[model samples]
Target: MNIHFIAIGGSAMHNLALALHKKGYTITGSDDAIFEPSKSRLEAKGLLPKEFGWFTNNINSNLDAIILGMHAKPDNPELLKAQELGLKIYSYPEFLYEQSKDKTRVVIGGSHGKTTITSMILHVMNYHEIAVDYMVGAQLEGFDTMVHLTSENEFIVLEGDEYLSSPIDRRPKFHLYKPNIALLSGIAWDHINVFPTYENYVKQFSIFVNSLTNGGIMVYNEEDAEVKKVVEQATSSIKKYPYSTPNFKIVDGITFINTSFGEMPLEFFGKHNLQNMVGAKWICLHMGVGEDEFYEAISSFKGASKRLEKIAENNNSVVFKDFAHSPSKVKATTTAVKNQYSNRKLLACLELHTYSSLNTEFLKEYKGALNSADTAVVFYSPKALEIKRLEKISEEQIKNAFEQDDLIVYTNATEFKEFLFTQNFENSVLLLMSSGNYGGLDFTKFKDLM
Candidate 1:
């Protein structure tokens, strides 16, 4: 099949292109600008477009399908030409559903932690040599690509994001999956630009839960009040299995979960992570994995990329970088790092780069998020605000919202980078949290300091 991707440099879209390419399909994609990993990966696979800009000539009737990326605007030239030609255009999620509808779909959904849960399940399955199709948010250690599709696999595991499916599709991406086995990790308000009100944002999850196929199985976090409320109130005819943070003890910076089989030590830590593990366990059980086998596989699993990933470590100090920007994620990540290394002085740095994080009204949700750290630093680029067309935020506003009297804020990336270099790495742990680059901060430099 010939597939042409519109704005395919997206994290998810490019992965889909690669998956189809591996499947022996004719895959061609165009993007205005492609970044590091996506650009290099696409080039390696011989799927990168010859030029960077979209051309109407790329759209033709010979193409079997047009996969639209979230990065593409509604009026994108290639998209307009396709629409004019009456060509079939599928949103990323819509096309994925079309491909996996025949299989038992296992979708992990929430405002956060969905990626890790999905990755964990895939890791366990890979360890046992179980063949299953998957589309995860992060690039796992052993996985060649973020997405894999095969006609032979009977099941597919997907990280169900609550964000919009595509520019042309207003529905949440998870709603498109229509999973037979699903998990909702937790709910936290984000993407203020799209879902203006908190109520509206949560309503999307309600739609997602209700979208499950008949007799579907749902695994949810019972500890989260909002998630519990949603799952309990759902009138759909489905089986519900609720889980919470498993019993775990942190010994010598190692997190061990006391299971019925035995005490299992994990390479990962944090209550949120533990909660994700239990939820993944329920999904794995439903997928024909025994309890004992699940524990055995999970014990050897490292974490997904950028989710509290240990970037550097030394004899006395360590550095971590995470894809955490939401208020709940920021708070949870901060608390986890501080608790794991209680004896070390934790210096947590956060970058406010997302549209939701930069919103003046949404700032209040981050109140005391960094309180767990011994010292807290916040960074937001004025250039970022300008690019996002958001209102200019002041350091005072950030300090007031966090409710931390000693909070340090920086609007210039250069100054923040300079400040980062000056900090002492001895007897201290550093945690950098953001969904965006800290104005091009070199993460590898932290290893040398440690």
Candidate 2:
């Protein structure tokens, strides 16, 4: 197959491009700018563009398909050229559906925890040498690429994101995959820039549930009322398997899940993660993995990248960085860290870089999100908000929204980094959460900061 990508340097887009290249498809792509990791990986695979900017010549009638990434606008030059040629254009998720339409798609979708849940299933499957094509948002330890596609695999596990499919397609990405097996972890209002109202934000999940194939399997988090409501309300003929946080004991900082086979010790700890494990277990069971195999394989699972990932640890202090920017994720991550290290002084820092986190109205949803942190610090760049053309935010607003009187706030990255360096690490757990780069912050320097 001959395929060309528009804006191919994205995290997901680059991974898909690499997967197709490995599949022996003739691939070409263009991106305005390419960052590290993506650039290096694509260059290594010989899929990197010859130049930085889009070229109209890149889109020709000979192309079999044009995979449009979210990074590319509807009026993008190359996109227009492809449209002029009457070529088949597929959104990232649309193309994924096209690739795995014949297989039984097991999609994991929710406001948070989607990446971790997808990673767990893939890890267990990989451990048992189960042959399946898959696409997960975060990179797993043994996986070479975030996406893997094969013609023979009977199943494909996908991390179904609820974000917009493309600039032109207003539908949620998860809705594109008519999954034969699906899981919805929890529902929380997010993507305020795309879905303005809370009802509108949640309706996307409802639509996703309704889109599942007839007589499919749905594994959901019954502990979350919103998720339960969505699943119960769906009129589909799917067999529902609801799961909650399994009974677990955290002994000496290690977590163990009490399973039917016995207790399984895990490298990661958190109530939310335990809940995710049960959900993943249900999906794996439906995919033909035995209960014993699931428990044995999951014991070796640490966690997905940037999902409560441990970065550095010393005698008295441990540091973790998470990709938590939404209110629910921030609260869940902060509460998880605090619950795990109850005796330690918890210092949690969150960077509000996303449009929803920076929005004035959406700030109220964050009420008490950082309350579990003994020391709470909130940081956001005014320059970033300006770039998004969002309304300016102030430290007072952040403090009022979080309802933390002693909350430390910083708009400057230098001051935030300096404050971090000056903090006392005596018997403390430090957590850094954000989806952004924290304003050119070099995380490697903090490896030995403890």
Candidate 3:
């Protein structure tokens, strides 16, 4: 197979390029820019493009297919050339379907927890010596690449993203993978730039349920009211298996799940993760993993990267960094930490980085999101506002939106760092939540300063 990728430096796209390269496919790719990790990994595999930007000369009739990344615009030069050449162009999701059509596909989908759920399934599968191809959003400890493909694996686990597949392909990425087994965690209105309306955002999930293969199994989070409604309305011929948060207890800041075998301790804590485990259990059961076996494997499961990850910890103080910028995620992550350590004071700091988080209209949805924290601090860079071309937001507006009278807001990264430095860490858990870095604050260096 011969494939050329547009915007191949993307997290997912680069992984797919490496997977195909390993499979003996002649893979070539181009991107307007490439960042660390992706650049290093692609270069290591000899898959990095000779130059950065797209070139029409890179497109040729000899290419078997063109896999387009979501980052590539419709007006991309290489894409235009591919179209002019009358070449078969497939969005990354569409190409994934082409490769895994013969295999049993298990796709985990939702606004959040999709990565965690997919990671849990992959961890259990790997522990049980189940050889399967997979793709997960976040990088797991054992996985070399976010994507893996093979001719022999009978099953493939895919983390289904609800974002648009490609510029040319207007469908959500998850809609491309018509799964034999599917899991929908829950729905929170996201990708407002694309979906535009709440009703339209929810309708995508409906389309996904209808797209499942005949007699497929749908594992859903019954605890989520919105998810319950969505699953109940799913008129497909699929078998529905609903799950909620499993019975668990927190002992000395550690979480454990109660099972028939006994209590199994886990490295992760939180209701969302507990719910993720239940959903994963159902999916694994359908894949022939026994209840006892699933418990045994999941005991060693840590967590997905950036999903409430412990960055720095000591006997008295612990610092966790989470990729949580959305209203629902902020609330869940903040609530989880507070519940886990009820005896300790929670100092939760969130960076308003994502477009949704920074948007003045969407700010009200975050009301009481950080109420669980003893001291809640919100930070957003004014330069970020200028970069996004958004109107300047006032500190009063943010405070009013969150409806927290005691909320402290910062528009300068230095001031935020100084505030963090002066805080007392003893008997406190510091939670830093953001989808972006706190304005170039090296977390590693910050740990030493603590």
Candidate 4:
């Protein structure tokens, strides 16, 4: 198979390129710029273009398929060339569906927890020596590539993202999966630039639910009222399975799960994580994994990268970094850390990096989201707002939006870093949340201080 990629330097796109390259496909890709990790990884596989930027010559008639990334503009030169040649063009998700049409697709979808839940399922499957193809959003501990595809694997686990599939593909990426077994972690409005309103954002998930294959099973979070309502109204042909926070206890700041095999300790924690585990458990069960086997395998599951990932820790303090920019994710993550380490003072700092999180209209949803923290700090960059073409937001607006009169808000990364460095770390936990690097601040430098 001959596969070409546009905007190949993207996290997901590069992974997909490597996966296909490893699968014996003749792969080629182009990007205006390639950053570290993606650049080195692609170079190692001989998939990186010799020069940055799209070239019309790269899009040829011999290519069997062209996979487009979200980073590519609609008028991208290579994309236009491919269209002009009447070649087959597929969004990343669409191409994934084309490859796994015969396999039992297990798509994990929701506003949050999808990556963690998908990672758990993949971890258990790998532990049990069960072979399955997958396309996860985040990098897993043992997986070399985030995407895997093969003719032999009977199932494919997909981290179903609700965002637009491509620059030209308006459909939500999850809608293309048509899963035989699906899981919805929860629904929280996001992607304000695309969906605009909360109701419109939610409607995307409803459409995703309706797209499931006939007789498919949907494992959803019962604790989320919005999730419950969506699952209940889903097509009757699909089987509904609802899950909530499982029985678990935290002892000495460590979380343990209550299972039939006895109390199994975990390397991860938080009520939200526990809830995600329950949904993953149900999905595993449906995939023919027994409760005992699931528990045994999940015991060693550390966690997905950047989802409540422990960057550094010591006797006096611990530091975590999470990909939590949305209002609901911010709240859940803040609450989780506070609940997990009730004995310690919590210093939660969040970056308003995403378009939704930085939007003037969407900022209101974040009211009291960080109230659990002993000290809450919100950071945003005026440069970021300009790049995203969003309305200007002030520190006062952010402070007022959170409804925390005493909330500390910073528009400058230097100021934020200075504030962080001056904080007293004794007997405290620092939770740093954002989808982007906090204005290129080096997180590793602060790791030792923890």
Candidate 5:
């Protein structure tokens, strides 16, 4: 197959390009801009565009398909040319569905825990030497690329993102994956820019559930009320399996799962993670993996890239970085860290990076989200708000929104770094929470102080 990509420098787009390239497809792509990791990886694979910018000339009759990324605008020249040629054009998700139409699709979807749950399932499958094509949001330890596609693999595991597929395609990416087996971890309203209202945000998931293949299985988190409601109202033809936090205990700062086989010590900790594990187990079971085998494989599962990832640690303190920008994720992550190390003083630092988190109207949802931490610090860059063309928010606004009297807000990265450096690390845990880089603050330089 000959494929061309529009705005292919995206995280998922680059990975898809690389995956197709490996599949012996002639692949070419163009983008306005490409960032690190994506740029380097694409360059290494010889898939990177020689020059960055779209060329209408690149789209012609020879191309079999054009996969569009969200980065492309509606008037993107290449996209217009492709349309004029009457060539097959698909949003990334649509193309994925086309490729996996013959395979059993297992899609893991939720506002949170989707990546971790998908990673766990992939980890167990790899441990069992189960070869299956897969596409996960985050990079795993052993996986070379986030996306894998093959003609032989009977099943394909997909991390179902609810974000818009492409600028031209208004449907949520998850909606395109008509899964044979699906999992919804939980629901928390997000992507305020696209959905606008909480009700509208939730409607997307409902649509996703409705899109599942007939007689498909849905594994959901019973503890999540919204998810429970959605699953209950789902068509009776779809089999529903619910899971929650399994029996587990934290002993001496280590989390152990109480399974029928025995107490299994895990490299990863936290209640959210425990819940994710249960969901993963149910999915694995559907794929013919026994409880004992799943547990054994999961025992060594460290974690995904940035979900409570331990960046640096010592006897006195441990520093973690998480991709937690949403209010619900912040609360859950903070509570999880504190619960794991009860003896330590938790210093939770969060960056208000996303459009939802930075919006004044959406700020109120963050009330008491960081209450689990002994000291809560919220950081937001004014430049970020300006770039988003949002009304300026004061430090007071953030403090009031969180409804935590003890919360400290900062707009300056250097000052935040200094404040962090002054804190005594003894018996304390630092949790850096943000989807952004916290204004490019170097956490490594301050690790020694901690």
Candidate 6:
């Protein structure tokens, strides 16, 4: 099959392209811009476009399918040409559904922990040598690619994102998966630019829950008030299993799960993650994994990339970088680090990079999100605001929104870096949270300096 990707440099899109390429399909893709990792991976597979930017010539009837990425605008030239030629175009999720429709789909969805839950299930399955197709958001320790597809696999695990499927498809990506087995980790308002209101944002999850195939199984977090409300209201007669944080204890900075079999140590910590583990456990049980086996497999799992990844560590201090930008995520991540190392002084710094984080109205949701940290720092780039076409924010507004009188906010990247360098690393844990780069901060340099 010949597949041409429109705006293929996306994190998920590139992984899909690689998966199709591995399946022996003819894959070609184009994008206006391709960044690191995607560029290098595509180049490695001989799938990188010869040049940047879209070309109408790339669209042709010979292509079996056109996979569209969110990065592509509605009027993208390649997309326009495909439409002009009456070629079939599939949004990334639409195409994923097409590929896995014949299989038992297991989709993990929520405002947070979707990636971690999906990755956990994948790790357990892989440990037991169970063959399955899958797609996860972040890079995992042993996974070579973020996506994998095979005709022989009977199950497919998908990280069900609530974000829009594509520029041309207004529906949430999770709605497209139509999972037979699904999990909703939790819900916290995010992507304010798209949903506009909390009710509207939550309605999307309801749609996702309803989209499941008949007699589907749903695993949800009962501890999340918002998630519990959604689960209780769902009228579907499908089987439902609710889970919360499993019994666990922290010993010498390591988290251990107390199971029926024995006390199982894990490389991951945090109540959010523990809740995620229980949810994943239910999914694994439905997938034919015994409770004992799941625990055995999960004990070896470290974590998904950037969720709470340790970038550098020394005897006296540790540095972590997390893909945590939302209010709930910021709170959960900060609390996890502070709880794990209670004796250490936690210096938590977060970047206001996403549209929601930068919005003045949405800022109030972040109040006390960093309360667990010994010291809290917030950074936002004016250039980022300009690029996102968002209103300029002031340090005073950020401080007031956080309700932390001592909270320091920085609009200058240089000043932020200088301030970070001046902090004492002895008996401290530095947590850097963001969904965007801190104006090209070199993490390696910071690691070396610390």
Tens-digit lDDT string for candidate 1 (103-167) = 99999999989999999999999989999999999999999999999998999999998888888
Those runs of model 5 whose alpha carbons end farther than 4 Å from true positions after fitting are: none
Would you estimate the TM-scores of all the predictions?
0.99, 0.99, 0.98, 0.98, 0.98, 0.98
Question: Which pairs of residues collide in candidate 6?
Answer: none
Estimate candidate 6's alpha-carbon lDDT, on a 0 to 1 scale: 0.92
Candidates' C-alpha lDDT: 0.93, 0.92, 0.92, 0.92, 0.93, 0.92
> Can you give the lDDT of residue 42 in candidate 4?
95
Which tens-of-lDDT digit does each residue in 1-450 have in candidate 2?
Answer: 999999999999999999999999999999999998999999998889988998999988899999999999888999999999999999999999999989999999999999999999999999999989999988889889999999999999999999999988989999999999999999999998999998998889989999999998899999999999999999888888899887888877778777777777888889999999989999999999999989999999999999999989988789999999999999999999999999899999999998889899999999999999999999899999999898888889999998889999999999998999888888999999999978877887777677
Q: Model 3, stretches more than 4 Å misplaced?
A: none
- In the range 389-436, model 6's lDDT, one tens digit per residue, is 988888898999999999988888898989988888999999999988
Tens digits of lDDT, candidate 5, 228-287: 998889864799999998888989999987887778899998888899999999999999
Clash totals, every prediction: 0, 0, 0, 0, 0, 0
Worst 10 residues of 4 by lDDT: 441-450
| Quality of model 5 by C-alpha lDDT | 0.93
TM-score of 2: 0.99
